[model samples]
Structures are given as structure tokens and as C-alpha cells.
Target: MVQHCAGLPLAIVVLGGILATKNNSLNEWRKISDNVKSYLKKSKNQRPDDVLASSIASSKQKERDGGEIAEDVAESYLMELVESSNIRSLLFFNEFFPEEALEKSLPLEVLNYVKEHEDEVCNPLVCIFMISRAGTSCLKARGIWRYMFNNFKLLRALNYEITRGDHSVGFKLPSDIGNLIHLRFLSLKDLKFSWIKLPSSLGNLRCLQTLDLRVGNYEIHVLNVIWRMEQLRHLYLPFMCKSRTKLMLGTLRKLLTLVNFNTKNYYLKDLINMTNLRELGINFPFNFENFNEKELGENPFIIRSKYLHSLSIITQWLILSIDPRHLAHLLSSCTSICKLSINYARISKLPEYHYFSSHLAYIRLLGCEFKEDPIRTLEKLPNLRILEFESSFEGKEMFCSAQGFPKLESLILGAYYNLEEWKMDEGAMPSL
Candidate 1:
């Protein structure tokens, strides 16, 4: 039977041992029955039995005789094995069965066998865990989640991918997900949870360092909860709700190396508060009018950022009418900024009365209109190396004077509607 049931090696070993003990006598058969009964009567240590049952239960239905395993018999044997002792010991043998073994379809009876032994499938003591939907009709089958959530608590790294036939189906997360305090990494990608909201308790995963939640159209309201996790170093949230809501930016200020932030409507004050931020990317409309320019003007936007080296701002429109002096003051505050990008801005001309910084090395102007000579204004940068211009400009004459850029290295002139000629001295002609 061991060699014949090629798919279930562990079950074959255990059941074959019992069969060998029975020899070929009715007395041995009676002993085997009694032993199985006693094994079931023992404590809830049937992890091995549950694993064996799931392995055997998932075996291809087609038998050696070209017939499928009878659903009733498969289910009955699985139930009997699950009720046996030494179930918890099965968690140690993840290599016993090949991954392909669970790919085959099983009978409904085999599914019922798994459903009955669900508790044994996931043992908190076992480092190796398995959850199979091969025979189960629904994910909500009794004891299914209990086994999963309980076992998840002990996992150091978890990769759970469950497939429901229907696209509209949404899986509900167990409320006790926070119990996985030991989890350091978690990945949930290409999943459908449109109807379910992430539990706030997930914030309790204090030890988690990496979390990737890249599901589509799933609305998550746990930003506040996520903000409280001080130990989190990397978070990948590619998709989120567009509805405006106040985010807890102040909570993330403590992260010294926070490199990426792909969110919208985030309070600028909260972002400005993160003194240690490096690379930052934000996509959403911001109402500059709401910024407390008067009170916060004492400490301008750039002044608070001592470590900020790169900044990118994208929105529908940029308010150019902002007090140029205030804008210049804010720009001068960032003593360390090396790269800056502004998209859809209204400011066409650079302010003449402003004090410029020497650290500004690169500037990218996208979809913006200028009222004054942009090139002449950009000429103030003694250290400017690269400049990119995109979209047509209302001004016709381009500023290419020697005094404009003494140290300029690369100049990309693009999409200027009525550009006639670049005015520059022969000595100031850039090598490019």
C-alpha cells in the first residue's frame, strides 16, 4: 500500500507500520482498531496525523486500477487519523511531501476529512505549516481559520496565497492577526479584499520590519495604526483610497531612513517635521492656501530640512502668486537640497530679490509657465549642473548668457513654442 499510494509517503509510513503490526490475522486487526481508537482518545497531539491525512487526502483520486479513491473511504480514514495521538509531532516534516502533491483534486469526502481535522493542520509548535483548499468547499469551513491564525503566530516569515474561484470573493483576516508578534516579514500581493477592512490590531505587530500590502481596490483605514509601529523600516503600499483623510505623518518622523512616501493629501507640516528624511515622493493635490504661512513662516519649509537632499512635488496646478519673497525664503532654508522637481507650477519667472543657495545642483521644471526670464533667473545658480525644461513657454527669448551659468554642465532645452535663438557669449558656450 505504501508504494501503491505513491503520493502520501508519511501516511503510508504510519498506516503501513500499523498494518505490518496487524500481520494478516483478525486478532491483529482488532488490535489495530483499538490502537487507533486509543490514539484518538489521547491529547490534542494529532498534528502528525492531520498532516498525514491532508497529504493522503490531497492525493490524486485516480487509483492504481484507474479508478478514483472513493470519497467516503478517504474521508473516513482521514477523520480516523486526525483523532489519533502524536498529531503535533507532524509539524516537523514539511519535506515529506512534494509541493505538487497538493495540486491534484480530491473527493468531497476527502475535503470533509480535512475540515474535521483542521485544528491539527496548523500546529503552533510546528515550524512547518500547511493550508490546503484542495477539498474544502469554502474558506470559512469550521476550524480552518483557527488553525491558520494560531499557526501564523509562530511563523518568522509567512507566504500565504489562497485562491478562490470567484473574483468577487473577499477573504476576511482573522481578528487576532496582531498575535503574530514574531512575524518579521509579510507579503500579500494580487489578493482581493474589497469587502474586508484591515483590522487596527495589526498595528500591534511591533517586531515587523517589512510589510507589502499591494492589493487592488482594497480600502485600508489603518494608517493611524501603522503610524504607531516604531520598528517598521520599510512599507510598500502601492494602492490606497483616493478619499482625502488626515494621515499621522508625525508618527513616521522617528524613522531615520524613511526613503519613500507615495501618498496624497498628507499634511506638509507632518512631512516637514521629518528632519531625517532622504528621498521623498508625494502624488496628490495640495492646497498651499491652507499652509500656515504666517505662523510657520518663522521656520520656512526648507529651513527645517537639514538632511533633505531630494524633493519632488506633483499636483494639478502650482500657485505662482505666492509671495515670491516667502517662496525665496523657503527655498533658501534648505541648505542641503541638491535636486528639485516641480510639476504643473504657475511660477514662470524666478524672483530677483531672493537669496539663492549654492547647494542647488539640479532643477527640473515640468508643465509650468513662467512670467519672467527663467534662464536669467536660473543663471544665479553658481553650482547648477543640470537643468531640464519641459512644455512650451510664453517667453520667446531664451537666456543663454555667459553670466547666467558660469559652471553649468548640461542644459536640456525642450518644448519652447517660439524659441528663436539661445543668446550666449562665445566664451560661455557650453561644451554640450
Candidate 2:
């Protein structure tokens, strides 16, 4: 049955199992054999086993040193189709080539086949091209980018990372990148380019959802173009040409994740406009000495983010001390917040009259000082399940006693330099 199935190893194995069944009979066997034979004859003017062997042979040829046998056979088949006679490229052969061997080596014959059959290639499959080098010299190789971009149009993703080596040379992206309108994800990391001006045609990629560009030294003007992509969901901007620029929240309302906003002297008001933002990480300037408790209370950035669920601020103590009123307002706005992390440089007294988040399930405080009455403030958080305090100083007699946490389940305290004892209620101790 395997032989009759034109060497289709999978079909042969499956049929062998069926033949071993008790219900299998001579008539059933005959029917299966006849169907396999018919399928082979219809596929080509050869036995099914012979056709499968030919396919294997062609695949092997393409895999081994980009041999010409596969290309010749594939080209012949295409020419005979007459209907697709104009199609010259043998990309199909390239697709069938073994992937493992192709990574460390490129077959010249395969390249030649693709070039010669370029006109014949009618339908191209989605392909990913990745280039990464440790040093800069390798990135300067000529014609590499052009050759790849010109030949590959159905690219779904492109990731290129290169570092500097000898001379300060910059790399350039292929000019025809716009042709790959189907691109969904693009990542250019550590590229040596000094100034990258995105092609306006980038907006044509209506399907693009992610664009990541990271360079050590570059004037990135492509952000304006990226902002036009309505489908964009994730954006990472470690550095940009313009400093002290305010991002329009309306333009990035669709963004769900943003990172590396490491800018100097920027206002939080710029982010307040992003109504749909779910996760945000930014470094705001800190001036502990000049901080005004009243001015911090008026900060509009904290008042506008009504839909925020997870927040990580530079310092919880600074914000709380600078403006406890603003902190209270910010906490009140985020009723849906589930996770909160605050890093304070120094310990500050907690507000006397404060409301805890009803939805908060996880909280982490680092490098902060907690008073002896730490549990008193935490008692307001009815839903807190996990709490972590790292490298923090808490007053003595700070124990998980009955009056402290009634519903807290997980507690982790590290480097509690001043912690002496933990208090827990007689019967309200959490089931840890």
C-alpha cells in the first residue's frame, strides 16, 4: 500500500495501521489501493510512488549546495503549465529547501534560480529576513539590504541589529521597504544610522501593528509617520531627535503598551490624553529639595488617567509627600487598578486621612521608610492579597497582628533593617 501510494510516507503509515484492523477486508484493501493509484495518476503522468520520489529528489537537490536539479525540474513544470508561463522565479524551490542548512549558508544556485525565475514567480509566500551582527564592519557589506528587499516583497517581519566596529559608518534600510505593505512587525535595534527619515508611504501599511526602532545615535523623524498607523498597539521609543517634546495623547490612544519613554523634563500632562492606555513606564524628573507639596497636589497628570489599571511611579513617598492630595486623587481615579509599585528615595510619613484602593491585589514598596503603624495604613486596603517590601525601613513592633491585615494572604518582607516584631490578631491571622 505504501508503494502504491506513490511513496507518500504518511499515507503509507496510516494505511498500514488500517490494514491491521480486524474490520479490514480484501475488498476494503482493494478500494484503498485503487484510490491511491488513481490519485497518483491524476497528479502526474507517473505512479504515486514515483511522483513522491521525484519531489524528494527535487527537495534534496535544492537543499544540498543549491543544486540545479530541483530548479530545472521546477522550472520545467512551470513552463509546461503554459497558463503561468510568464512566471519565471522558482521561489517554491527555495521555500522547500532545508531551513537549518540555509541559515549558515546561502546557495548561489538558489539565488540564480530566483533571479532567472523572478518574472515567473506569480505568487510569493510570506517570509521573514533577520540580520544581526556583533560589530559594525559586517553591517557595511554592500548590496545586502538591496538584494534582500528587492527579491522579497511578501515580508511579514524584519529584524536587523548591528553594532559599531572600526570606522563610524552608518547602515541604511532598503529603499523599496514600502513595497512590503503586508509587514506586521518590524524591529531595528542598535542600527548605526545617524538620521532615519521614515518614508511617508509607511502609512500605506494599514495592517502594521508593531514598529520598534532602537538606535544608539540617530535622529528619529519616523515617529510622525508611525503615529498615522491606526492599528499600532505597541511602541518603544528609547531615544528621539526632539527632546522636551509633548506627545499628543489622541494620536496614541490606540496604543496598549509603551516603554522607554526616558525623556528629560517632560510633563505628565502629555500622557493624560491617552484614554485607552493600559501600561505605561516613564521616568519623570525628581527634585526633592524644591518639591512643593501644594504644586504636586495640582498636577493634572494624575487626575486625568481614569482608566489606568497598573501603575509604576518613580517614588511613592515623593509623590505622597510632595502632594498627598494629588496622590489621593490619583488613587481615587484608578478604581480599577490591580497592581501598584512605588519606589521612594527616602521614608516619609503616611497621610493621616487616606483611602485605599478597593481593587488593588498586589503592592510593592522599595527603598521607603514605614512608621511603626504601617499596618494602620494598610488596613484600609480590603482587597490586597500580595504585599512585598524590599530594602525598606519600618519602625519596630511592626508585626502582622489581628488589627493589621484581615484578608492579606501573601506577605514578603526583605531587608527590614528596623523591623523587630510583627503583630497579628488573636484569630484573624492570614492563612499563609
Candidate 3:
């Protein structure tokens, strides 16, 4: 029967459901097994792919435009047939598949299967850790969960893409997750809860290397535990406003990448301690202190991060307190930045005709209004290979200088609804 299921989890679930409805008599199960064996033997010559494709198409139609199917039909049918069924036997029979079957299936398939029938298989899904693979894992839960932390002990990575059911207003995860001693990578994405409170035991994941969470839209708080994940190499989260907890960042010496860093929660001194950082993404708050040329020169984090390669800044547009020239000076401090992306910034002018970062090779600007010809300054980047401008400038005419963008390979000028004249000088972009 396991072979007949062909290592497909969905097929196994359906077959298990069918058996769950039958009486727990040896003869009953034997008859069903015999019938399945006989059918497989007789149909050995049939194309399984063709049959499976047909079955998938039929299932899709009944599922209605790829949306959730009604579970009432499945539940009512199971209840009618197994009103007196033994739950223990059902649990026992569910593990008929070989251990290798669980390991071979992709994590995405397991997540989908569990989410599809969460109403029916939620308990079994966690009780049998067969759903999670050893190295990398993903699970999506809609309601309160208790056993997942206990079962996912050996995982090296876990991405919890959790959602809230209609009745669920707040979400909380078990502190036992700290027991996953081998965990290294963790992420939480697309969470929809009024407030998410992380357990203090989160500080116990000493081996955690990567922490990624999309916590901007929700009121996610109490994340001081992050300071304990000392080995974190990559951190992806939006600015957390109104936090008094200070990070013991010197312990996180291995940190190399940060995404959407909030200046409000941290200070330049804190960033200076992470001197090994490479790639960074920051949302420059409107109230951020302006840095003078002397201060920018003294900030070792920005001036001495020789490994810094990619930088993304999403500027706050509601207030324009800092002069645009000072912004250029701050970027120039990152002498090694190669790729830069700026969004929603209100820089009205470029400082001079010289490129800000000597090693900058790629640039992407979005929703920034430039008061003058940006090309005059951008065309001077010696190592620039790709330039993309999206709804960034209001100028209708742009002129490129002779022998400009010496090494540029690609240029994408998109969403410039007002651009009318683009004039290139003789020998302009000669290497293009």
C-alpha cells in the first residue's frame, strides 16, 4: 500500500483517510490491500503520469480557481464512517510510509499539504516530524500550535510563515523552540497578527546564523532576545520604533549583512562595532541626525568597512531636514559600496560631477525627484555596469557627456512618464 501511494504525501493522506473510515478488522484491511495490489499489478502497463495528471486536473476543478476546498465534505464523510473509530490506530497507520519517503519530499510540498488540510491533519502533522527535513524546513500554521517545537528539534533552519485565522487576534510561539540546538537559520514572513510577542527563550538559539523577519506591518514587539543570537550573519527586519532595549552588538562580531536597519533603535556607535558587515539595507528616518563631513570621516563603520559591497537606502520623504549634499557625503563614506538602491528619497541635486562611491558598479533609484540632470553625475562612475532609474526624476531632458559611463553594460530608464529629450554627446557611452 505504501508503494502504491508512490511516496506522494497527498496520496498517502487520502489513502489514510480512506482506511480511517474502515473497521479495524484484519480481514477488512486485508481485502482493501489485496484489491489495491491486484489493481496495481493489472495496471502495471498503464502510464502513471497520464493518470496523475488527469487526477490533478480534476482536483483543481473541484478546488475552484486554486482556492481552498471545503473540508466539511471530507470531515462529514469521515465522521459518518468512523464515529467509533480508534484514534490510536489511525495514528499508528499514518506512519506506514518509509522514513526515506519523508526526507525525499521537498519542504514546500509538506507545507502545502499541511496547510491544505490543517483541519484534519494538524496534530498528526507535528506528532510525526516526518514533515520537516533535517537541514532546511518550512511550516505555515494558522492557529495556536504546541507540538511543533518539540518535533522540529533537529532542524538547522526553520521559516515560520504564520497567519492568523479569523478568530485569532494575537499569536504566540512556544518557548520550547529554544530546544532546537542545531538551528542556524530562521525567518518569519507575511505574519498577520495584531501583536506578536517572541518568547524570551529565543535567546537560547546560540547557533543561529541568519534571522529574517518581515515585522514592519504588524505590531511585533519584545524582540530583545535577538541580542543573544550572537552568531547571526544576516538580519532582515524593518525598523522597530519605540524600543529602549540596547543590543549587546559587540558579541555579534560575525554579523555581515543587515536589512532595513532602523537608526531609531540603534546608534552610529553600535554600527561601528559591526566592522565586518558587508551588505546593508537602511530606512533613513526623517528625524535622523545629519552627519557632517568630519563626523562621516570619523565613523569607522562607514569609512572602514572595506568589505561593504551592496547598500540600499529607503529615505523617509515626509520631512526633508538634511541637505541633499550631506546625504552624498554619507554615501561617499562607504568607499567600497558596489551596488546601491535608493527609494522614496527627495534628493533634489547631486553634489558634483564625480561619482560618490569609487567602486559602485550598479545603481537603482526609485521615486526620488532630481532637480538637475542626474546623468552629469551618474555618468562619471568609473566601474558602473548597470543603471536603473524608476520614477526617480522629473526632468524632461537628459544629456550624457562625451566618453561617459566608460564601462556601463545595461541601462534601464523606466517609468519616466515625463521624459521627452535624451541627447547624447559625440563618443558618449563609447563602451556601451
Write one digit per residue (lDDT tens) for candidate 2, span 17-111: 44554245554466446444433333434686787676665456543542323434455355335444366765533323444454436557445
Can you tell me which runs of candidate 2 are displaced by over 4 Å? 1-100, 103-137, 140-143, 149-153, 160-181, 189-207, 213-226, 239-244, 262-267, 286-307, 314-327, 343-356, 369-374, 394-401, 421-429
Report the alpha-carbon TM-score of model 3 versus the true structure.
Answer: 0.62
lDDT of 1 by residue, 129-166 (tens): 23442211243332555555665577777554444443
Candidate order by lDDT, decreasing, is 3, 1, 2
Could you tell me which residue pairs clash in candidate 3? none
TM-score of each: 0.54, 0.54, 0.62
- In model 3, where is the ten-residue run with the lowest total lDDT? 130-139
TM-score, model 2 to reference: 0.54
Local error of candidate 2 at 48, Å? 32
Q: Please give the lDDT score at residue 279 for candidate 3.
A: 83
lDDT of all predictions, in order shown? Answer: 0.55, 0.55, 0.64
Q: What is the lDDT of candidate 2?
A: 0.55
